[model samples]
Target: MSDFFIDIIDDDGADQGQEAEVVSGSSSTWKIAIIDDEESIHQVTRLALSSMVILGRPIEFLSAYSAKEGFELLSSDDEIAVVLLDVVMENPEAGLQLARRIRQELGNHNTQIILRTGQPGYAPEEVVITEYEINDYKTKSELTRTKLFSTIYTSLRTYQHLVAMEQSKLGLQKIIDSSASLFQERSIREFSEGALLQINALFNIHSEGIFCISSGPLAGDRDMIVAPLEAEQHRIVAATDIFKSYFGKAIDDIDDITTKQTLHRTLASKEHQFTNKYICLFLNTPSQWEGAIFIKGDIDEERLDYELLSVFAMNVSLGLENTKFFTQLTQMAYYDMLTQFYTRHGVIDRCLNTAVKNGEIFSVCILDIDYFHEVTESLGFEYGNKVLVSFANRIQSILPADSVFARLHSDVFAVVVFDDKPLDMEFIAKQCAEAIHVDGDKLRFGVSVGVSQFLPEDNLSGEELLRQAEIALKLAKEVRRGGGQAFTPSLATESRGRIQLLGELREALASHELVMYLQPKVSLIEEGTVVGFEALVRWPHKEKGMIPPNDFVPVAERSGLYYELDMYVVEACCKILSEHSELTRIAFNLSANSLNRPELVDDLENLLARYGVTHDAIVMEITENSMAKGGIVIDTLERLQSKGWLIHLDDFGTGYSSLSYLLDMPLNAIKIDRSFLLQLHDSDNAAVLLKGIISICKDLDKKVIVEGVETDSQKAFAMDAGADVAQGYLFYKPMKLEEAVDLMKKQS
Candidate 1:
């Protein structure tokens, strides 16, 4: 055998004079444990492996004299790579039991075990190796210096492979987790910093780096032109370690020429460049900005997984693209594209945030350009856009620096001023009144303003405050085109009441709460005989008592409910004519909106047919304005007159009375308004005007019905002026169907 083993065998008793020395642990050494009942074996094994090294790491020898001592030593030191176990200690199966316990109890599966026994017959090699989880089985005589070196070297190499695989698994897991965290960043700079940090962690290196971006075309550009890297065009968005101070500076400002050149080359080639000294990872996004990450560190080129790095780079690119898309969406949402002002939603958010910060009173002003539609209709929309932009600029110049200005909608802008005083609306109007130069044309426009205050005690939300301003704006437009109005609590109250009444009115129509009342028209020449009756609609509210026509008629018109109301009146009149033949005819008024309906004639005829009433029994009365509406109203009137229905112009002298309507319209009669009769007692000019109107109607072959003749002097004057009909309280007031029937019975 080798001299090393001859010495170990011959000098068996020599170790009795000395103890085996214990070696301290080290990161660059593989731990080995020697366990046996004989101190000579421990000394011999330690001497044989003292100068040996495996996988570039020296051995750390831990000596134990018995199985119990070996178990204690191995349990305390988990880094032990290989154990030389002795079979016969205090008991025959002591080494066998300790081997099983090391694999099971201590759970040190990675530590390789080699069983050696001086009495091989006591523990058979096959049984001990199979039953005990031992890596190798050998007799003490067979374990010479050569075999011992080969066995320990092979076991230590195996342990090295296992540790490397475990570290690779953990590093890959960390990469996946870091990728997820990088995607959560919303800004380019934030994402870059996270990427740099994650890469450093992946390699376990504390390196310096800079993330630089160049302004140019994006990933999917057709031309694929990359802008020249000027000092202003290239920006270092993120930096780490020694390069942290270089963040937001130009890439050219980097003192290292190698780093700057590598970044430029990587971006130009659109590919990653890996080297022993540094790594340049190319990055491209959908935002048309190309970039690169320059990391200054030595990475193992042969060991680096390029495929895994590419996957991480793809995730970085996607994260950058997502951030760019989100930024673009935010810009579109918060700013007006044309005027570069805050949009309505952006302004409201600003107002809410400001209110929370200041907790002080402020005013919101809404300015609407008057006749803006006319401007768009006369000029092209392009020109109109220029006017709008110029107008916004003018208003913005006059406002305070801290004020929030927004474009609410077309031709409407809003302003939120952080002050107790309201905006000087008159001065704003005057400023906008100046002519705007658009395409070499001077265009003058007026603005109407509405203001609403936000009081902390009122506890109004931003949306509610804006709503109140809009309400005042509507009133300003109605009160005067170029004036301003402040919001009042009564206005909102009145608006709410109107809305409630409208809802109730709709229900009233549906449930038959509206009743038809008739006021008799008498013929003075026939000694106060009841000639015909005028149909009037009255609402007997369940809560508010009787609602007059003046109260609800305008509401119906404004709400587009006048058509249904008019048809209801017509149907009621037709029913009356069908019920009592003595009531020869009934006259009911039609609003201008109702008269303009295409189905008005058909609806009226259908109602008459349903009630079995003759066409001549229904008289369609419209105001002068309704007749003067000219196209559909006049055509509908002529159609009804042709069908044997008389069309009377009611409230004749009240609105826009045109002589053309009196002469050219299909009118069978004219009812003079009540104002003329009321004016007769005040002036003789009223008498002359009334008589002249009656004379003109007579000459035009039309009958005259004098309405609202309440006094004796009015009745006498109507008869003397040759009026065909006189409707007044002097004859009969408006009453229900039962009362009208009783009055007609007395007349009969």
Candidate 2:
């Protein structure tokens, strides 16, 4: 055993006398060499140490008649820990030269050297001890058995301490290096296992054991223990017993579980005979662990385990805590908030990896809700959210176990089927649409599915697959009714055109690529006189011939690019109306999404207030179809009216023309649908319906305007039906702001 190990065992042992004897015995086994020209001195030193033994090993003596013999003995056996030499051996400086040569020439730093002499008068104690590489000096007469034994023991103890310190330094360095790589571990099991190994090694403890506390899923698993061989079977048995005692019990009993506090104390009080074979060098109180390391040797006799374990416990706690936090955070980042499914980014990452490995044949399907925005506008955002959530749940319920779903955006979702089966993919898509039923009100959504198969060694990533599926979805949407459209490479060419249009759309609002056209609302009393103008939004694409608002409006809303467009439109209206003070008040229409914004009223008020425009001058025309069913739509419209802005109910007869809203709404004007006028000559019902609408308006004290009049007969009919104003292509088609002003001047 090393001298350092002996000292630790000695100091740490509770039985002081027994521990001292053990330490002495253990130290005595280290060989001690004596070099002098005297045989009597060696015999005397051996007698001094004869009674001492370090553990079971006894100290043996080697006597040398000259320095040459001492050097030869030390050279042959490297285990010699100490050398006692005389300064005046064969010559006065011979022993001094040997000491220097042993350290410098032979590189033998392990051996401890003690200089002794018959005459100390020649070499003083301070000079011989310092100038030469020797431990101590003693006179021949002072070399009694007790002193000699004391000197040797003290020297060995000092040497042992230095070796131990060096080992501890290296261990600390390894711990620092190991701790840095903790995050790189693949699994919690692997991380815990590696940490235990590093911690035990750091303490220079070959006998320690570690185990984790089992909780929740691991409740009954008692065999889950991590430990080294030195911990022995007793620790394992004790741990199993400890676990079973509290396995199903509440955690409140954890405080009073120590054997030392209860079992050992009781045994001692009763004077009962007990053996300590199972006791270990873990004298310090054991910390509670779902798991723990049990030491089996005399813990009070060895403080190394206790002190080292304290440090290990701190490191392990920090590592485990970090692992848990990172693992949870990683999961949350990859999942969708509403569906608890993989997000577009997460699904794409998984697909790309699968494609790279070329293992399973993966197929991707893109599904879009048919006219979903119409429902959102009609039923309200709250109901729309419910429908979306229900859609996700239904897909999860019916999809194959191997398939995965992701919400790509508002109305578009993607599902990746593992098996390359087109029939299965189509069935799942249809099931998702059909399952969204709410009693009498089954959801009215149609799904367009796009199918594409995974290719081996495909440079195409998830992003490319999404693009291909989107192309197929576009083809499906073009069909009007619900159906599946398989992806073809030729579709990518048409997709490129749409992508290019999208890029231009991004700059459309910013660059004023979108132009407002004013359509004249001419008076029925006189053909040339204009009553009002309807503001229309038109996007003129540089590459594609004029892209209709219907084609791009939904796209803008889906991409969250509608807010910018809405803000720009509101701001532009403020500027345009601020210049047009001559014509009757112009009305600009807003989408349901814009009206639902809590900040819409504030934003609109601020813009008008900035330009010094009165609420009466600018009319906010919201379609009845859009605002009829949304929760906050009525409240928002009332709030705007309360702020003194005129609200016009546009597209009056198209959808959900609630009589209650027509009677109760705080609207300034209502535009009659032109369908009644087109069939005025053909049907008497059209005339009767128009008269009923006119009578309702007259009763409500609201002004009436009629749209889509293309001839003199329709305009005259509107004027004859108690309509206050009339507008259509016969008056003027939508024209540019400047052109509308010119036409107004001409009419005036």
Name the candidate that leads on TM-score.
1
Residue range 1-748, candidate 2, lDDT tens digits: 3233444333333223232344221223668888888878877777656656643346677778787888888888777877888777788888888887787767777578887888847665466556555777777767665566667767776655544454455545444444443332222333444544453334433333323322322211223323322221112212233344432222223344443333333222422112222222222212222234332223223434445555565565565455434434444444566766666776776554556466567788877888889877888877777788888877667767767888887877888877755645466557766846653467656777887777665567677877778778878787633778888888887677656666788888768889788887766666567767777788977767788778887667655677677777777777787877765567787877777778988888899888777877778887886666567888888888888988888878887877777767778888888887888999999899998998889789888888888888887778788888788888778888989888878867
| Candidates in order: C-alpha RMSD to true structure | 12.6, 12.8
Candidate 1 ranges with C-alpha deviation above 4 Å: 1-282, 286-310, 323-341, 369-394, 397-402, 425-447, 524-527, 624-645, 683-685
lDDT of 1 at 258: 94
Quality of model 2 by C-alpha lDDT: 0.65
- lDDT (CA) for every model shown? 0.77, 0.65
| Alpha-carbon shift of residue 621 in model 1 (angstroms) | 3.1
Best by lDDT: 1
Q: State TM-scores per candidate.
A: 0.63, 0.53
In candidate 1, residue 479 scores what lDDT? Answer: 75
